[model samples]
Target: MEPTTTTPPEPRSRRGRRPHGKVRRRLAGALALGIGLLSVGALYSVVEPAPQTAVAQAADAATIAKGQDLYNNACITCHGANLQGVQDRGPSLVGVGDAAVYFQVSSGRMPLARQEAQAMRKPPTQTFDPHTQEGADNLAALGAFVQANGGGPQLPAATGEALRGDDPARGGELFRLNCASCHNFTGRGGALSSGKFAPSLDPANEDQIYAAMLTGPQNMPKFSDAQLSPQEKKDIIAYIKSVSDGNNDVGGSGLGGIGPTSEGVIAFVVGLAAIVGFAMWLGAKQ
Candidate 1:
């Protein structure tokens, strides 16, 4: 009691200043924590996603989540929230696997421009191109999300030239037997009934051809491993490449590779023109 009486009252400013300093320190710590959290989130978003060797590769939750986001934004309109597909707009993607996705999307045939007899290839969506890591990551994520919902045909581990086989001769036989009717003997493509047509293979790369065979995009029939062995598929690819690269155009100009009908037409036109000119010359001489 005596000490209390002797002690002067603590200054109001000092008391207030100490409490204010403590409050400032707490606020500063809170701000630092918030910044740290933001930095971590930014880091995660910027990191590159891994590429898949096979479409069946299991995806982590984060990747699936990212894919889900992409689907919701770009695909939900036609493909639906669950990928069941919106009737009259898009087909059900239940059994269509990543192979289909890669074929349709990577080739820019999907996210359809409009209702048509066929989805034609064009420049791919900026996010789906496989040449860039970001595009590849996005494509992988979207494919993963679709695959997670329903497993389907997975792309092979091998890609590019690795998919080519040793025997172009055998490949030519297979191609003639299975693909020539629609794709033409040289893969130049041809008209089908209605508005549909077989798209030319000139623009397609090796992976695209493989994916098309695996998924049977558009009117093309799916060639399962049971129907065509992997080696056989490779051979077919080699044959296609050989023809596509002009290596097999040993007969000179392929004349658009439209086959003998075009050659016959050209021959007839040239012969007709020559005969007409000859007749005119004879009349002039007479």
Candidate 2:
């Protein structure tokens, strides 16, 4: 063969010598990185945190399991096996958290004596008789169960000074808007559609009020932190304390804090007395 040596293949350039597979992989990796960044940006835009969701850490798994068992046995009959509640017997317990359960059971307002207009608070009609330390343990267990199920607001380990806000006036405005219709501007509470009534805030302590707001105990609507900020809640509490602490213009009795009812009664009585006195004076003149 004429020189018999095929001309040496021209030396490939370093850039052009790169393997096709390696090039494809590098391009794929860059594309994946760009897609990930876009996805993160989209997620950041959509997700927002609620204000009052800063609850204490979750309860232990054992406590939750025990609570589930107790719920199944004692509460299932009325609250439903799944905690969805019975049609005519009990309202749904799905979102009602440990705070609600504690308030209802510990206060003896639950395990209702009868299905009535309202389940008023009363002495524990049914006592628990656990063989060992089960009574106290059971209560704790049940609380854990309701808590784990996930629904209502959770109580914090430390309510702290943060629970008390500085703006009572703002609280009053908020109260008028969100709570006045049912609770009355004075926190004296009012009747609802049926025999059920919003109980007076006078008897409710800070924790109790917070719990009620969080859990919506009975027929009340749930107020998640997303709906009302914690600072706002504190302000509401301050307003309640200010109004309930006996600083009103009522002649010392406070008259249950219902302005119209008390004022109407007073005006009616005074007006009637004045009319009678005028009549007597006219008669004397005659």
Candidate 3:
């Protein structure tokens, strides 16, 4: 009875209980925040689109494998086991890229049958023909193989008429400035020093021309995108098509389409022959 009286009804507010309540509230708030974050993360995982990066990587790996197989079978002899090239047999294909491969293989200038001053264009083997599905696949595989070894120029996605540009006049100007010296004013092609010669544009298709520009093939100077933009390249293709397809030409005859030199020669020959014939007729009359 004396102890209870002295204790005197310990202060109505219990400090211990207050602190415990505050701690419980803080723990509840923290648990609620954690649950909210976890729920948001779970929702995002279900809604987000599955990434295709891994699938793309797998496909790329398969393509590279097929290319490597083709290279080992056909190209390894000249290009070396690692594309470093053989001593005098073939140049290194390391940095040449798919554009060069397409040009050389598709044009039949590669798989060289014989060693010569310059590789001549011939009919491509059935395996490399772009017209057939099998051939096209094989060609792509081979190009991919070379491309994987070292990166370089690539061919345009378009083909044939699609590659032609809308502005032929501007293309003509560019052709004259850069290509006229070797290909002639009409894209007729001319002789160069050594055994190398500028190939006639007469036989070149859109793909070949585009590949040549990208790769520079042999003696031709490489016109990178920096030098000639893709649009400019297309324009050049248009000009070549216009001239070579005979859609655009001067007055008459075109004099073999070799430009003024052939025209001048023909003019002189015809003029001299006419003069001589008239003189002979006059002599006969006398």
Candidate 4:
């Protein structure tokens, strides 16, 4: 039939042929590659997590250990080796927090001068003899040690402007109840027993006030956040600011805020002396 062989299907050139075997191999390879990639990704997801560097963990451990040692040696007698505190000697320090410790110890009020009606701030009875170093290292060691044992509020690493409250009314109320007992309603600061006094608030900055409250330096009661609540403390600070602004109408100097007793004494002495001098002059002239 005109070359009836039909050209034998033109010998099916390799280019036109499907090459089924090669196609199957490529498909299998692609599937395997995808599975391998997925398996690797899954394994990585399981193993990797948020990182906590080994150095940080080690430092924290060291700090806790040092704190435990210090508490045992310096604070254990009255506070108890476990920080449960002796029956009447000291209060339990479980959650009192680091702020309390810093305030009392740094201010030289702790390691108490002696057991009395209150613990007073005085020169540190026992100085931190860091036989090894000075400055930050010593402070870090002490701070770490106290922090480990626990007793009071913690000073924030960054006390921003947020530490200074915006609300003065609340600050005033807080000041009256918690601070005014010793500081006076006017924030003039008042006498405690002995030579110790509350001192004037005129010079105190936000940090000093916060530290004073947290530490309760020298015979001052500890005001943990649990006790005073941060909001109340802010209000008290506002009140102190108001009083310190000098709202008095008198044209003369206010001798701090010790009040009329001293003022009256000065007036009597000065005025009476002037009157007597005038009388003597009149008699001499006659």
| lDDT digits (tens) for residues 97-197 of candidate 3 | 99999999988988998998788999888988887888888888888888888878887789888999999999999999999999998998889988888
Q: Pick out the ten consecutive residues of candidate 1 with the lowest summed lDDT.
A: 50-59
lDDT of 1: 0.87
lDDT of each: 0.87, 0.75, 0.88, 0.67
User: If scored against the real structure, what TM-score would every candidate get?
Assistant: 0.75, 0.64, 0.83, 0.56
lDDT of 1 by residue, 1-286 (tens): 5555477886677776898899999999999999999999889767734344233354467688888899899888898888899989987788888788888899999888989998878889898888899998998888878888867887888988999999999999999999999999899999998899999998898889998999898789999999999999999999999988876766567788876366777889999999999999999999
Q: What TM value does model 2 have?
A: 0.64
Best by lDDT: 3
Ranking by lDDT: 3, 1, 2, 4
In model 1, how large is the Cα lDDT of residue 136? 89
RMSD of 4: 8.7
lDDT of 4 by residue, 84-113 (tens): 889978887776666556556654557776
User: Which candidate would rank higher by lDDT, 1 or 2?
Assistant: 1
lDDT of 2 by residue, 16-62 (tens): 75787698999999999999999998896677443323332333666
lDDT score, candidate 1, position 256: 88
Candidate that scores best on TM-score: 3
Root-mean-square deviation per candidate: 17.3, 9.5, 4.5, 8.7
**Residue clash pairs of candidate 1:** none
